[model samples]
Target: MDSKTPYKANLIKQQKVCERNFHKLMKLLPDLENNDNLVLSFYLAGWEGQARFQVLERAPYTTVLHVNLDAAWGQWLKLPEFRIRIYRDVRMAEIISVNKDRHFKAIYPYPNEKMLMPDEKEQLNQLFSEWLNFCLTHGLNN
Candidate 1:
């Protein structure tokens, strides 16, 4: 097998994930043009949480959105937060920033100063997918 085979495979998988999450985000962003901010609440199945979405930048073919966990409970919880750049024409959404840091590499050297994992990029995208899935499945627009 070629050395690049694994990387190519991962890239393909990540693209699928991003594309799927884009559709999910679109579902959650209904009536998007009228409002800049939207919040969704989830309380069913003994789970309680909220997700806040804001449009940071809008363009003809691309949009940047900031998403975060909105905790009505308290401030002690560490929320999962990220900024997504959606390519409308391509139908893809990707995480540009996460955990308050704006820069992330596709791969990182282990035991580095920041301690980011090697697959940080893929992890962040996967995380965005999970969050989108959870919110769409459990959330109610508010």
Candidate 2:
């Protein structure tokens, strides 16, 4: 057996977790067929992944809320290191970034009192739910 086999296998597992969580987050966004202001961009590569949900405004850099989730793994690690960044401005004037080492119990837009795994459904759901609400209340128009 190749020595790299186990590492590759672990990476596959982490990639699936990232993909599944990415889809869960995507479901919470308003449908793309009906809304042009909101866009989702996702990319995954073996043990690493990145997903972004962006709310655009009338003018570029005028207004935007960008939520990004990134995951990666070190050798021999089963779970990837996950990080979440919430950016409230087009120019990224206001930003919050959290890593997996932190406990995640509450949702974002609120104090994340605890840390959470990147793939945890409940936290992902709450995060996206609040994001959608924020977009709507702030005039996403779609």
Candidate 3:
């Protein structure tokens, strides 16, 4: 066995973990059939700021969710980034006058609100684990 091989295997394992997390989230959401008005954004990062994947979706009466595997936290913590944005009053005449860009900006700011907050780093790790299970079982993606 080669020394470098072990490092390569570890990298692959991490990649798999990220992929599984992404798929698990997607699978939890309801499938879109017709209309096309919803939008989704996903950012994939590894280590510091290495981006690996980006996905977007658009459909009516749909929910958009972003799932990210935050590798920066390391083993001491498991940090998963989650975001949900809902658009409303699109079909109304008066609401149609609203600025599209500005509305989107207001809903999705640079920083998002957290659904799960823990008192400590260790607690945060536990929260992430619980979140993964809850999102998977409760179908919170949509």
The candidate maximizing lDDT is 1
- What 10-residue stretch in candidate 3 is worst by lDDT? 92-101
- Give one clash count per candidate, in the order shown: 0, 6, 3
By TM-score: ranked, best first: 1, 3, 2
The lowest-lDDT stretch of 10 consecutive residues in candidate 1 is 1-10
Clashing pairs in 1: none
Better of 1 and 2 by TM-score: 1
Q: 1-142, model 1: which lDDT tens digit per residue?
A: 4444443337888889889988998898877666789888987557588888899999999889988887645367677788999899999999999877877777776657988766778888988888788888888898
Instruction: Kindly report which residue stretches of model 2 are placed more than 4 angstroms away from their true locations once superposed.
Output: 1-9, 32-53, 56-65, 68-142
Error of 3 at 135 (Å): 1.7
Q: Residue-wise lDDT of candidate 2 within 14-116, one digit each (tens)?
A: 3344344344334555463245344333323434433444544334323333455433543354422223332223112222223334444322322234433
Span of ten consecutive residues with least summed lDDT in model 2 = 86-95
**What is each predicted model's overall lDDT from 0 to 1?**
0.82, 0.37, 0.32
* Best candidate, TM-score: 1
Query: What TM-score fits each model?
Result: 0.85, 0.25, 0.28
Runs in model 3 lying further than 4 Å from the true structure? 1-9, 32-130, 140-142
Once model 2 is optimally superposed onto the true structure by TM-score, how far is the C-alpha of residue 126 displaced, in angstroms? 14
**Per-residue lDDT of model 3, residues 1-142, tens digit only:** 4434321223343334444443443444334223223233222342332111122344464334333443444467744453332232221100111112112211222123632211222232234335555444432121
Candidate 1 overall lDDT versus native: 0.82
